[model samples]
Target: MLILKQLILGLLLPAVVGGGIFIFAKSLAWKKESEQKKARLSGWLVAVALSAGYTVGYTGLEGLPPFPPREGVHWLCYLSIIGLISGAFWHSSRWGRLIVQIALSIVIPRLLLNSAFKYTWGQFEGIIWWMCLAVAVFIFWHIVQESFTILPAGGSSPFVYFGLSGGTALVLAVSGSLRLAQHAGILVAIFAASWVITFVRQRSDNNKWQVFPLGASPVVALLLLGIWMNGYFYEEVPAASAILLAIALFLAPVGRIEKIQRLGARRSAIVQICVIALPVVIAIGIAVARSGLFGESSSY
Candidate 1:
């Protein structure tokens, strides 16, 4: 019953609330349209809707946040608010967005890894680990947002993330922490909401993403990174699985070539999702085999 409730509330709440926000935003005449068309042109709206859904669904699942946030996972709530504000206002300037991205890179790794740095590792080790992670976050965020601009219209980005979240959830479930898995699962719901909305709304639009809702990129990226960081460092996820899962979303843009684009919107999205599925499927299979979910010994 508890599992069913989590699935029910976790799945439905984010989808319903986030879907409502998307619909509302879609209805508004934000401004003039160019000769070329785009779908969900307002990135901040995407960020707002997804972030709001995450915050609300998180509350529903875990109840209210305690003062000072006793758990590091709880920090996502506050960081998301920060991400939303930064994403919403900085949509117009490229350099403005880059600055925000760099600042977050510096903060989030240490933010989630303070105790690990101070108590678990030596100074040199901590600095080395922090530098690599910060750099990776910066690069990943840059690629995803850039993809939003370059990739042909088809809502492929949301589809990629939806698949990524589902893969992460399954991997986390088999990694000895259902708690962490549920966190990833919340993201699954949020992206699923976006996936449906984007796929529907972009049926005719095929312009380059000008004034696109690129804001959702960082929010989605941060959630995935934070989940993996917490799961591996603080929970039971293996280092190998963590590495594999972290790079999974990087394959998202591989299917954006001219050939795939000519396949049309729906088919193009399918190709992109399939490309992303390579890493996700491998990670899930490895995680399941490692944990012996089917009652057999296996290797990671």
Candidate 2:
């Protein structure tokens, strides 16, 4: 019953709230001035939409966020607000976004992995793990953000993220932690909503360069990394499996390469997604086999 409720809260609630707000924003106008308004608000709006979905899901499943965040999930609620605030810098300038990215990279891993060091590991091991996670966060964010920028932008472009979110959700589920899986699934839902809105609104508009949330990629990337870290620390998820899942999302920008770009959007998208699926599939297989047979996963 809890899992079932998780689906509705994570999937249904976010789709309605986020998608509805975006649609309403479109209903306002298509004039240049109106578009200017959207341009300014678009990235922030994307952050808002994603945060709303995450916040409601967290609160519904876990209850309202408490002061100082006693639980890790509670920290996620606070992180959502942080993501939104930091995401605004994405629109400001590349330098501005990079600074925020660096800051978040340092912060998120420490927040999530502190429990591992405090409760299970020695200070040396903790420092090593924390450094690795922080590096991972910065590297992943830079790769995904830069690649998405180079990739052909269209209504349904950035498809790799949708795949990443769905695949992460699956791995999280099998690795143990229904709540984190659902949260990952909510990411899939939010992107699915974006695809629909982009298709409907972007197709007719002449301004393909309009201000979009593509700049706000860090929020989504860090959010996924955070969820994956939570699974690794709390659920005994295998290190290799977690590693593979993170690598999968980074492959999407390969479609934007000069050789691949010649193939056009449809063909390139197919090739890109195939590249992504390979790691995700292998990760899932490893998680399934080890958990079911070898029982070799590590945990705090």
Each candidate structure's count of clashing pairs: 2, 0
Write down the lDDT of every candidate, Cα atoms only: 0.74, 0.72
Candidate 1 structure, TM-score to reference = 0.86
Report lDDT (Cα) of residue 169, candidate 1. 87
Off by over 4 Å in 1: 29-41, 201-212, 256-269, 295-300
The RMSD (Cα, Å) of candidate 1 is 3.3
TM-score against truth, every candidate: 0.86, 0.85
Candidate 2 residue 290 Cα shift, in angstroms, is 2.3
lDDT of 2: 0.72
lDDT of 2 by residue, 142-217 (tens): 7766655655565434355667788778877777777788778777887778667767666677435332355456
Quick one: how many clashes does candidate 1 have? Answer: 2
Off by over 4 Å in 2: 1-4, 25-30, 33-38, 155-158, 201-212, 293-300
